[model samples]
Every structure is written in C-alpha cells, then in structure tokens.
Target chain A: MEENIKFLRSGILAPIKKWGTHWSLWPVHLVTACCGAELAHAFASGYDGERIGALNYGIARQTNLIIVEGAITRKMARVLRITWEQMPDPKFVIIMGTCGLNGGVFWNSYHLVKPFEVVPVNYFIPGCPSTPEALLRGIRQLQNEIRTGEPRSSIEFEKVDLGKGKMMPVTPKSPKKISLAPSIVVNVPRKADEETKKLADEISKLGLATTVTGKNRIALRVEKDELVDAAKKLQNFGFDHVKNVNVIDVPNEDKFIVEYHLGSYSKRELMPVVLNLFTELPRSEPKLKSLAKIFPSADYMEREMHDFFGVVFEGNEWMGRKFLLAPDTPEYPLKKDFKLEEEKYLR
Target chain B: MEALVISHQKQIGDKMLEGLISGLFKIFTSNMMNIPLIEPLVDYLMQIPLVNLLVALILWRPFFAVIILPGLVGLLIYLLWIVYWERKLTARVQWRVGPIEVARPIRGAIQALADGIRYFFQEAIIHREAHKIYYIQLPILAFIPILLPLLFIPAGNVVGIKTPYGIQLIVAFIALIPLFIVAMGWASHSRFAYIGSLREAFMYFAYEIPFIIAVVAMIYVYGSGDPYVAVEKQNIPGAVLNPLAFIVYIIAMIMATSRLPFEIPEADQEIAFGPFVEYSGILFGLVMTLLYEKLYLMALLFVILFLGGWEGFYVGILGDFCAPLVLFIKTVVVISVLVIVRSVYARYRLDQAIRLGWTSYLTLSIAALILGMFVGVLV
Candidate 1:
C-alpha cells in the first residue's frame, strides 16, 4: 500500500500527481447507516463539498477515495472489503461517525463490525452521525495527508484536568449478584381473568402442563414428541396462527426450551388471547416436531430460529440451513455459551 | 569499361537520394504558412542549416492541419479546457464555486492537468475475466477513428487531405467511433459493460440513420460534398436555408456524443459508466475522454455545415494560419455552449431516447432532407 503512495511521490512529476490526488478526491461513498445523510448534506448546496474538488462518484473501480458512512455490520464488512479491494492503487478511506470508529450505540453488539479492522482508514470523523462539517474536515485532513507524507487530526482538543479542584469520582465495579444457574422461566403464574382461567382448563384437557400466565395469556408445556399433537389440538381451539417462534438456550440445565406464541384472526374472542406453547429437548440433540405444517405462518419463523439457535425442527424443510445471517457469520450465535470476539481498543 | 559502368551506376544512386531530399524541401517551403507576426523570428531561424528544415516542416500546411491547430494538439487543449469548464459550469449552475482549491491563484484552471497526472501514475488493473489483449489495446485503437476525421476536415487552405468527398469522409469516420466503444465493452466482459455496450449499439442505430440524413440534407443544400464549397456557398448560412436540418443536426450531435439527454449508454448512476466500468487509472482516463474527442470532431463538422466554417474576421498577422485559428475558436465555443446542457437537463431513458430518435427525430431529418432539396434548387 505504501508502495502505491511512494510511486505517486517518487517520480519527476510527483508534485503534479500529489496536487491532482489532493484536489480530485472523488469519494465512492459506502452508505451503511445514518451518516450517509450527513454525507449528502456535505455535498449538497449548503456545504458544497465539490467546491474543494471532492466530488461524489458512484463506481468503486474508477474512484480513489471511499467514505464509509456509519457502522459496518457483520454482513456489510464483506461488502466494505470488496469495495476497497476493487479500487485501484493509492486509494484512501475516510470513515465517518462514531459507529465506524468504535460502534457508537451498537458498541459490543454481536453483529456490529469495526470498519478500521477491515480497511486502513485515513481519517475518522467522530459523532453518532457526524455533522456534515466534520465530514468535510475529514476530507480536508485526507487532502493534507496526500500533500505531506504524514496524517494529522483536523481538530485537536486540549487535555484539561477537571479533577484539579474537585474530588475524583470512584471507578465503578462489576455487579456481584449474577445468578450462576438461573432458572429459565417461561410459565410465571399470574392472576388471570376468569375467561383466561377457563381457557387454561380447556387446554389442560390435552393431558399437558398448563398455566395461566397473564390476563389473556396461557402457557402449555408438552413433551417433545407430543408438540405436533398439541399444536393440532390448539389449531382446533381457534389458535389459527403462530405469531412467533423463539428458542431459549439453558446451558446449566442441559436443555433447550422452544416456544411458539399462538394467536387467531379467524376467531374473534381468541384474537385478544395469546397461547404460549413450549416444549423442551435435550441440549445435545435438540430436535422437536415442527408446528409449521399446522400453522403456515410458522415456517419462516421456524427457519429463523434454526439459524440463531441451531435447533432442528424435524419436519420443517429449512431446518439445517443458515438464514437471516451473512455466510461468514459464526453458527448458532444465540447459543448461551457462544462467545463473540471481544473488541480491544489500543491507546 | 566494366569499372567505369559501375561508377556511373553509383553516381545515379547518389543523384536520386539528393533529388528526393530537395524535392521534399521544395514541397514544405512552397506550402509553408506565412505568419507575419513570426516572420523576423522565422527569417533568423532560416539561416541555420538543420533547424530550418524542422521549422519549415512544422509550418507546412498539411503537417500543420494534422498535428497543430484543429488537430491533435487542439484536441488536447480542448480536452483540458472542457473537463474543467464543464465541472465549473455545473458547479456554478448549482450555486457553487467549483474546483478552485487546486491552484487558487489561477482559480484552479489547471485542475484537469493535475487529474491527468494522477491518473497517469495510478495502477491500471486488467481484471482476470477481461480479454487481456483487446482490453489493453482498444482505448489506444479508438483514437485512430477519432484522429482520422481531422485529415479531411479542412480549415481554409490548411488540410491534411483535401477531397471532393470531405463531408462524407468525416461522417463516415465519425460513424466508426462507436464500433471501438462497443468493442471496448465486449472486451471488459463484465455485466455492466455488457449492458453498456448493448445500449451503445442500440443508440448507434437509433441516431445513425437520422444523423446521416441530416448530413445528406446539408450536402444537398450546399450542392457539393466538399467543405470549402459548403462554406463558400453559405452567404445566407446553411442554417437559414434549411432550419429543420440544422435542428435535426443539433439533436443528432447530442445523441451521438452521449450528452446528458441521450447519455443512456454511459449512465454512471444506472450502470456505472457502462463499458468503461472495469477500466481504472490511466486506462480509465483514456476511455473517459473518448466521447469528448468525438464531440470535438462532430462539432467541427457541425460548424462547417450550419455555421459558416472558418469565415470569421481574418487576422493579418496569422495570414493562412488565421483560418485554423478561427475554426478552432468557433469549435471550442460551440462545445462550451453544448456543455451547458449537461447541467441543465436530466438523462433520458434508453427506450425513450430510442423511440424519439426513430420516430419524431427521424421524421424531422427526412423533412429537412426535402427542405434542403427544395432550397438547393433555389440557391
């Protein structure tokens, strides 16, 4: 990479090369988040980034500079890298917003990726969604770097000691009351209305554990093999659709609790009531009968659950395949023991 | 007797070499440009042995037409001027100052120079999938058709190849330019390039027929295919004689050169500059200017057809060279005015531009042809 920059600076026409690159910093903007809006404002009539010779171009192959806007997610990181690689030699990258710098509001999020880790960033404009002025400043700093062989911050803040006359605040510690083997509770008993209680009694007739969880909610626990039977009986009970499919990983108990929230649009009275149907499977071989056949809406949700938790829905066609995640993402991200790589910041 | 005969043959060979050199010198001096402003300097230089030959060759009319004014050198200057002017003009239209930071003292007039230098040094990547030979060769090859038209496009007494079919030759060469562009797209082998080249071929058919008809109309109105005759007969100017043809020619110029309204083939936003999408660095810079060069050629033809060709007030100092200077200035002005359309209008869709070209635009050209025929008889 330095060889490319060196080639531009070593020739007899180096001054001309440097001058052109400095002024003609056409950015192929990779808009990942809200900072893209600020980028537009910078180039629009108000700020007019083109006045300084920084035009916004569309193609990655023809342009020299890339302005990465906001946070790059796990999926977008691949795209960012590809765009960078597609660009010709002596290309520069200026990442905008605090998200691109350190993830901003999405700090330590499982899906958020630090852009600097993917490409060599020339300048960073720090803000949640950086102001357009800061974006222009970032471009100016990059221009300055091209002219001189060194990079510097556009704005420098003075290090002030606020603790000089006041008491320094104590550093906080991590909370000590974390439960080691916390119980995974899906059915918390609550005082239900008479109608919900009567409905719970009717569901209990299927020879399963039933509890009234809330005013218009009931929880039914069935064995893994009896899940299909329970869903068929519930469909007959006017729970015509599966509203959501979720998987809870209980590492300490060595079990996976799968829940299907059932609701109805066909039956008027059952429209307001939510029936929580759950079943447990052994952690090592977490397979359960899919309710997708009984409820067509459950198909996509079941596939998504399979993507996150690696829970095999025995009869669902999309059970073993990955969905709703980038191809490069780690498998079973929602598993309790799956550890994400912690981001380390250097001083 | 045998030795004497051999010596006689050697003397004949030496005489032929001498005659060849002096004959070329006679041709150069006879047709040399008579610029009064540089007379004293040229006279002083003429006394020198070796340098005088070089000086006379440069001032020679045929060489001057091909290499100097309204030719390669003029094209280079126009390229630098127009790129910067287009950018600055668009900036002004949008209420901005535009590209003034590069050389602030000159108001960034040399911005294009800097860009050219940067592109010159940057890497030119030929992707793995590209046709390596054609991908590398096509941009340079495209310049042939572009420069060839300059040979027949006369500016008064200065012309590379004076011909009876001057207008036809120029039009034919101009038509060949799009084939190179289409070939460039075929070599790139990328999806965007494929789409871009396909659009270029479609646009070629869309505007080519009407463009030819419009030129034919002018040819009819002028009563000859020669540019000199065309200019000489235009006391009323061709535009006044055949206004419909003038309008048709202007629209054809826009469509042929891929200016904003008909910029379907290389729509940067839609298909990422189409056939040139895969090119980078110096290769991209070369491909980028192909349209502008084509525009310059077509505009020259335009001035010769509708506008009076090189018929401006003759400068006494420039003499025979005055014609090319006036012609170059007029062509530049025509293009400068044309550049305003880029910022003013939005691009038309491929289908819409094609439909307009084949239907209404073609009808207009045919009508222009009829008008030219009627006017040709009266004039």
Candidate 2:
C-alpha cells in the first residue's frame, strides 16, 4: 500500500498522477443507507460535487473512491469488502454518517458492523446523515490529500486553555457497557387491572401456566409438546394472528426461549390484548411445533427465528435451510454463545 | 586489383544510397504543404539537412493526411474536446458545473487529459477468467479498423491510399469495428459482457443495414463511390439533393456509435457499462474511446457524402492543407452538435431501438435509395 502511494508521489510523472487523481475522484455509488440521499444531493445541483470533479460512478471496477453512505451491517460488510477489493489500486474510502463511524443509533447492535472495520477509511463525515455540504467538503479534503501527500483536516480547531478558568471542571460520565450475561425473565408476574387479570385467569384454566405481565398483556408458558394445543385453544378464543415470533438464547441456562406474540384483528373486544405464548427447549435439541398453521402470518417470522437461534420449527417447510442472512454469514449468529470477533482498541 | 575492385563496389553502393535518399527527398518536397502561416519557419528549416527531411515528411501531402489533419492528430484533438464538451454541456442541462476545479481558469478543459493520465497509470487487471491473450490484445487490435478508414478518407488532394471506392471502403472498415467490440465482450467471459455483446450483435444487425443503405443512397445520388467525384457532383450539396438520406445517415451515425438514444449495448445503469464492466485502467480508457473514434470516422464519411466533401472557401496561402483543415472542422462541428443528444435524449431499450431500426428507419433508407436513383439519373 505504501509502495502504491510512493509510486504516485516519487516519479517524474508524479505531478501529473497527483493532479489527475486529485481532480478525478469518481466515487462509486455504494448507497448502503440513508446517507445515500445526502450523497445524491451533494452531486445534485444544490451542492454540485461534480464542480470539485467528484462524479458518482456506478461500477466498482471503474471508480477511484468509495463513499460508504451509512451503516454497514455484518451482511453488507462482506459486500463492502468485496467492492473495495474489486476496485483498482490507489483507492480511497470516505465513510459517511455516524452509523458507519461507530454505529450511532445502532451502536452495539447485534447486526451492525462498523464500516471502518471492514475497509480502511480515509475520512469520516460525522452526522446522523452527513449534510450535502459536508459530503462535498469531504471530497475536497480527499482531493487535497491526493495533491499533498498528507491527510490534513480541512478545518482546524482553535485551542483555549481550560486551566485558565477558576471553576472546578465537571467530570465526564463513563460510557455504557452492555452486560455479558443478561437476566431475561419473560413470564414475570405483575399487578394488572380486572379485565387483563380475568383474561389471564381464564387462560390458566385451559391447563397452561399464565401470568399477567402488564396491563393488556398476558404471558402463557407451555411445554414444547403442548404448544400447538395451546395455540389452537387461543385461536378459537379470538387470537387471530401472530404479531411476531422471537427466540432468546440463554447459554448459562442451556435452553432457547421461543416466544410468539399473538394479536387479534378479527375481534374488536380482544384487539387490545397481547398474548405472548412462550416455550423453553433444551439447548442441545431446540425443537418446537410451528404455530404457522394456527396463525398463518407466523410462517416467515418462524423461519427468521429458526435462522437466528437454530430452533427447529417442525412444521415450517423453510426450516433447516439458511434464511434472513447471507449464505456465508456464521450460522446461528444470534445465539448468545456464538462469539463475534471483538473490536480491538488501539491506544 | 582486388582492393581497387572492392573500393569501386563500395563507391557504387554509396552512390546508390545517396541517390535513393535524394529521390525520396524529391518526392517528399514535391508534394509538400504550403501553409503561409508557417512559410518563414519552413524556409529557415529547409537550410538544415536532417530537419528539412523531418519537416518535409510532416508537411508532405500523404503523410500529413495520415498523421496530422483529419487523421490521428485531429482525432486526438476531437477526443479531448468532445469528451470535455459533452460533459460540460450535460452539466449545464443538469444545472451544475461539471469539472471546473481541475484547472479553474480553463474551466477544466483538460479534464479528459487528466482522466486519461489517471487511467494510464492505474492497474490494468486481467482477471483469471478472461481469455488472457485476447483480453490484452483486443483494444489495441480494434484500432486497426479505426485507423484504416482514415487512410482511405480523402481531403481534396491530400490523402493516403486515395482510391475510387473511398466511401465504400470507409463504410466497410467502419462496419468491421463492431466485430472487435463483440470480440472484446467474448474475451471478457463475464455475464454482463455476455449480455452486452449479445446486445451489440443484435444492434449490429439492427442498424448496419439502414446505415449501409443510407451510404448506398448517397453513392447513387453522386453516381460514383469516389469522394472527389461526389464533391464535384454536388453543385447543390448532397443533403439538399437527398434530404431523406441525410436524415437516415444522421440517425445511422447515432445508432452505429451507440450514442445516448441508442445506448443499449453499454447502458451503465442496467448492466454496469455492459461489456466494459471488467475493464479497468488503460484498457478501459482505450475501449471507452472506441465508440468516440467510430463517431469521428462516421462523421468524416458523413461530411464527404452529404456535406460536399471539403467544398469550403479555399484560402490561397494554406494551399493543399486547407482542404483537410476544412474537412476536420466540419467533422468536429457535426460531432459537437450530435453530442447534445446525449444530454437531451434518454437511451432506448434494446427492443425499442431494434424495432425503430428495422421498421421505420429501414423504410426511410429505402425511400432515400429510390430518391437517390432518380437524382442520379437526372444529374
């Protein structure tokens, strides 16, 4: 990489190469997220990024730079790496938006991957979605970096001494760190109004462990074999559809908690109720009866849950094959015990 | 006696060599260019021996025709200007400044030069799946047809390989260029390239018939395939004589070169520059300019057939050089005007372009052909 830079800087043709590359920084259009809109505006008439000779090209093979628009998830991270590899040498990367920097709102999210980790970024335009002017300014800075062999910040900050003030300095708060082992209690009993309590009491009479978890919310626990029977009884009792199917991996407890949040669109009186039917399965062989037949909307969500936690849904045809993730992604990535490569800190 | 004989043979060889040099010099000087703008410089340079030969070769009619005006040098100038002009014009239509920061004073006039330099220095990746030999060879080889047409295309008396069938030969050579493009696609061995080459092959048939008929119509109107005779016959320009052929030829030029309205083969958005998706660095620069070079060749032929082939006002001092200058300027102007279609018009779908070419465009060319036959007899 240094050799490539050296070749661009040291030869008799260096000036021409530098000048040409400086002016012709055609960024390949890799619109990963919302920041792509801002990139468009930069090149559009408002900001006119082309005035600085940064045209947005389509293919990776032909362009010299990549303006990574926003968040790069684990799946798109591979795509970002492949695109970076496909481009010819002496390429630069300008990461746009805070999601690409350190995952802004998606910070520490299971799926979010910092684009900086996937590719060597030359510049970062820090914003929720970097503005059009900031994008063009980033391009200008890249051009300047090409002209001069150094990466200099376009705007320099003026320093003022804090020690000159007499008042005590406010200490900064420590950053939040997520717990290694999270305590997940899905069926916690809670105080509820009469209607929800009556619903919970009526659900318990059907031979299932039921608790009122909140107002208008009831949690039902059933053994793996009894789940289908419980689903059928709830279906007849006005629960018409499955709002979501989720899986929680508990490595310490050595079990997978599968939950189905059921709702009713057919019955107006039952519309406000959210019945979360859950079952626990051993980690070694986590299998469950699919609720897809009882609630048809659960079909795709069941497949997604199977993809994430490797929980086999017996009646789901889409099970046993990868779904909702790229083919090369590590299997059962959402499993708590499935370790991701930790981000390294450089001091 | 042996020594004398050897010396005598040496003298004869030297005499022959000197005679050959003088004879070649005589030929070069006899048809030398008469540019009054450079008359004093040429007169001064003629006092030197080797410089005079070099200068004579540069100004010699045939050499000048092939290497300078309306040829390689003119093509280079046209490439730079047209690329920059097209981008700038498109930017204006888009309500933006295209590339002004490169050289702020010139409004980035040398933008193409910078891009060409960058392409030249960048890595030319010959991927593993490619037909290594053909992949490397095709772009350079493609220039054969491009340059060959220049040799046969005459500008008044200054010409290379001046033949009676100059127009037909040019048309034939221009037709040969697309085969190289399709071959480039085959050598690429990628999906996009495969689709792109298939589109190119379809478009080849789509436009080539009408294009040929259009040229044939002009040939019929002129009553000869020779450019000189075609020019002499055009007391009223050929466009005025056969307007239908003129329109057909212009559309054919657009389709043949894959200009915007018919830019199906390498629609960058749909197929990622289609056949050229795999190309990078200098290889891409060469292939990218291939269509532009084709445009230049077609425009030169367009000038010869319809625009009266260098029948502009003759400058007395410029002499033989004036004709090529006029031809080149006219070709460039035609191309410059044609490039606006890129910004103004959207690309046609492959099916739409082929339908237009086969049905409506074909009909127009046939109409022009019949009109040309009538005009040929009348003239």
DockQ of each model vs. true complex = 0.67, 0.69
Model 1 accuracy (lDDT, Cα): 0.90
Winner by DockQ = 2
| lDDT (Cα, tens digit) per residue for candidate 1, span A208-289 | 6799999999898888888888888888878899999989888878899999999999999888999899989899998888
Q: What tens digits encode model 2's per-residue C-alpha lDDT throughout A1-347?
A: 77876766697788888888888889996787899998888888887888877778999998899989888888898889999998997799999999988888887667787787889999999888999988888888898888887998877779976564755555433342334586678989888899999878887887878889889999998888999999999988889999999898877777888999999999896899999999899999988888888899999999988888899999899988878887666788787666665644431
What's the CA error at residue B341 for candidate 2, in Å? 1.2
Measured by TM-score, the strongest candidate is: 1
Give the root-mean-square deviation of each candidate in angstroms: 4.3, 5.0
In model 1, state the lDDT of residue B170. Answer: 96
* TM-scores vs. true structure, each candidate: 0.88, 0.85
Regions of model 1 farther than 4 Å from truth = A1-8, A162-226, A233-243, A248-286, A335-347, B1-21
Q: Per-model C-alpha lDDT, please?
A: 0.90, 0.89
**Candidate 2 lDDT by residue in tens digits, B201-244:** 99999999988998999889888899999999988988999999
**DockQ for candidate 2:** 0.69
